[model samples]
Target: MDWMMLGIVLVLVFTVGFVFAPLGLGGGMLFVPILHYIAGWPISGELILTCLMLTGVVSWGSGLVHRREGLMDESIVKIALRGAIP
Candidate 1:
């Protein structure tokens, strides 16, 4: 993998995170395409998996703050996690 392209993709993901996080979204929709098309990464499982992990991290960051502020409901979260995890 080209390190320079990877760095650019990371920066773009971080910047997109700011926009999407506010709306309670992960950057996967943008991330996968950015990595595949812009970064010239080939379409493969690893590319999609990378997008998944990156988006998961981005979403987790905002979720953490919301949880700390008690803006999240534990019961609903548990239900969602049950389905999501499986």
Candidate 2:
């Protein structure tokens, strides 16, 4: 719960988002491990929630660009969401 650590995590999340988002890799893969192992953040609800939110925002930003450029596939999204949503 250190503010400095939280700020660091947020910065890293934003950077990862910028780098990997266009490639369709949400930052979660890197975010979780980096936060847990490198940043020494605990594996807990707050960490998980923060990671998910940041990664999702990054993914959504990239997705919006792709969709606007006509590179997005509606059916593919539907299929993925169908499986991901429960």
Question: Stretches of candidate 1 above 4 Å error?
Answer: 1-6
Model 1 misses residue 15 by how many Å? 0.5
* Clash tally for model 1: 0
TM-score per candidate? 0.85, 0.74
| Tens-place lDDT digits, model 2, residues 1-86 | 58988888768777888999999998788988878976898999998997898788888899999999999889999999998896
Clashing pairs in 1: none
Displacement of residue 68 (Cα, Å) in model 1 is 1.2
- Model 1 TM-score on a 0 to 1 scale: 0.85
Candidate whose lDDT is highest: 1
Q: Candidate 2: lDDT of 33?
A: 84
True-structure RMSD, every candidate: 1.8, 2.4
